[model samples]
Target: MDRVCDGIAVITEGKKGSWVCDGMTVRKVVINPVKAVDTTGAGDAYGSGFVAGLIKRPGDIDYALRLASINSASVVQQIGAKHGLILRALPQGKKWMHIKVEKY
Candidate 1:
């Protein structure tokens, strides 16, 4: 938070999960595991999903982060960046609801 400019900072820890900092508080959200065939485009999926979630439901930080996790996990499960073609088309409905986000 000290070094980041006036904006939210998202730090992902691969399979472990991710930490989000907003210059004040830091929130950690764990991700569900998936068999990664290819890690290509996982980061891109996460960023796009997070932004899409925010656009769909502004001010819902948890929703955005969860969506990001879901997106990345989905990408890694498939082979190559082609999985991105189905981005939001993932069939895991309400998947994020089952994921527990540790309250800080």
Candidate 2:
């Protein structure tokens, strides 16, 4: 997959963890411990987390992956797909920490 794309992140479920490949670099994301209740919406959770991380952390694939991991973990610990969605702001020390989102 890395051969075709500039970077690729593979999300794993059920304690298997995740992996990321960005041409020259390959990294692993460890799963944080969380009780599982439902598997539905895990992908959406991961996508949202990844986008949030990209917007918040920019240029840091590792941070984005961790955010994705966190989002997915949170979702699976609840009953419904959107039940456990928790959006986190960028790190306090970040330069672009003033990102704001308005409903459209």
Candidate 3:
């Protein structure tokens, strides 16, 4: 599908990684392997993470894609989209590469 506007992210299921393309460049991101219980909310999780990354790191597309991957990974591990959502803070001992979004 030609849904990609500025850039595109391909979600690879049961694979080692996912990828993002910005027309001029393509970046493959490695995701930590996990057993997915349900995929009902993976897309939303990715979108949320990407947007969060964009908001936190205005011009870093790579960061956005990584955030999206992380979010999607967390979502699929749970049964529902919202259930596994990481509303605040990353996983255990995980540090945000970009500026962490602070609630005002």
Best by TM-score: 1
lDDT of 2 by residue, 1-104 (tens): 56567665454554566666656666666665678899899888887887787888787777777777777877898999988787555333542222221111
Candidate 2 similarity to native, TM-score:
0.74
Where does candidate 1 stray beyond 4 Å? 84-92
| TM-score (all chains, Cα) for each model | 0.85, 0.74, 0.72
Which of candidates 2 and 3 is the stronger one according to lDDT? 3
Per-residue alpha-carbon lDDT of candidate 3 for residues 32-99, written as tens digits (9 for 90 to 100): 66789998888878888888988999978778877777788778888876888878777675543442
Q: What is the alpha-carbon lDDT for the whole of candidate 3?
A: 0.69
User: Which 10 consecutive residues of model 3 have the lowest summed lDDT?
Assistant: 95-104
Better of 1 and 3 by TM-score: 1
| lDDT values for all models | 0.77, 0.68, 0.69
Query: Clash pairs of candidate 1?
Result: none
Model 3 clash pairs?
none
